[model samples]
Target: MTADGTAPTEEVGGWLDKLGALLRTVGLVVAMGETSLIARNIREPEGATAAGRAMNPGLRQEVVCQPDATGVPWWFWVWQGPTRDAPGELEPLCPAANLEWAAERITRVLAMPEGPP
Candidate 1:
């Protein structure tokens, strides 16, 4: 964390970078979001033509740092049924250091109806 609000470790950045590359090859858009990283899908909108497609922010998750016995561990966490005051809403996805598992699980949501979803 810094004045610019990006994550402190390049470990986080590096994981995101690699994940971004994999995601793009499969047609997902990846970028640094307001607080962390975001991957979105562009599905065909009704009446879609030369106009814009609907950007669905599916499976919105953000990276968070938590303390561990070894060191500070970075993770991507998604909020489930969040309320205004509940700190227990977040559930960890995967360690930010493990991009292969993360990207696979994250992109699973994009699978077509006939594929493994």
Candidate 2:
């Protein structure tokens, strides 16, 4: 239900594929967390995880495509609560078709902090 009466043309998994390809080529890990829900999991490259970090530091972000008020779907980054597995906020990034843009933004946000000196 966009401004017009038609449903969104793009499929949710399409975004995953577009973003996954770019992320994978760049050394990031892309995984399908919940296929039924179409959740995409992103993680830091192997050996890049900080030493002595959390139990699971590689996980970067989980993204999904959801519809807006008008029924047009957009990409959104799902943030868990302050603690792992807690409730968090949902922020839309870009349109579903802007898969590359969403991936770039994710990369920037998930970029590992500079190592000591």
Candidate 3:
């Protein structure tokens, strides 16, 4: 992490590498880590800071950011609900980047046999 709240160059790369390693463990051709949890932190355009950019290097499979609303970047927040709204989603948003508890969860999930898509 950098003093400006952006991620350091190496830090971003490291996170991306860690993400790749986690995905490889799961045998996923394309890893889909969650991001809504991390995206919520940004309120402004500049909020797409390096720290934010590096936070979710993995792909988002279920949710996407609402298009260009509030000037926040598309990378921030997971689009939730059946209508794909910006709010009211559950289960800690992105399973990949929910660093709060994901480290263990990811390890466990990756160890299990691939589930039905």
Candidate 4:
């Protein structure tokens, strides 16, 4: 990854750029609904709680965004409220079909703006 946090590969960079944009756009939509999408991963904690019994714990990250409040574009809203550990309830920010529709639009938007070769 670059010091600026961008991917090194062109393909990966392109995808990241698009995803970043989508994340921002969707985040706005989510914020407008008075919620946040805590995008994070699930990690198992160390150690055991009982004899011969290991208690694994999961950890996830979260971020808050506001509606019509343009500033932090990476933040999102949780459509499925909160979860036990892994961020939000893995809620679908948008339905699969709707995502497809938005993706198509994103593709067109990105295609319209080409970088230097």
* Model 1 / residue 1 / CA error / Å: 12
Scored by TM-score, the top model is: 2
lDDT of each: 0.57, 0.63, 0.38, 0.33
- Over 77-101, each residue of candidate 3 has an lDDT whose tens digit, in order, gives 2235677555545433232244434
Model 1, residue 36: what's the lDDT? 50
User: Which residue runs of candidate 2 sit more than 4 Å off their true CA positions?
Assistant: 1-10, 34-56, 82-88
Evaluated at residue 41, the lDDT of candidate 4 is: 21
| Candidate 2 clashes between residue pairs 3 or more apart in a chain or in different chains | none
**Model 2 Cα lDDT, one tens digit per residue, 1-117:** 445644444455655677677777666777664321222234444455456345655546777676766677777777777888787667888887786787788777767655543
Ranking by lDDT: 2, 1, 3, 4
Lowest summed lDDT window (length 10), candidate 3: 35-44
Of the two candidates 2 and 4, the one with more favorable lDDT, higher being better, is 2
Model 1 residue 2 CA deviation (Å) reads 12
Residue 73 error, candidate 3, Å: 20
Model 1 residue 47 CA deviation (Å) reads 8.9
TM-score of every prediction relative to native: 0.57, 0.66, 0.33, 0.22
In model 3, the runs with Cα more than 4 Å from the true position are: 31-104, 107-117
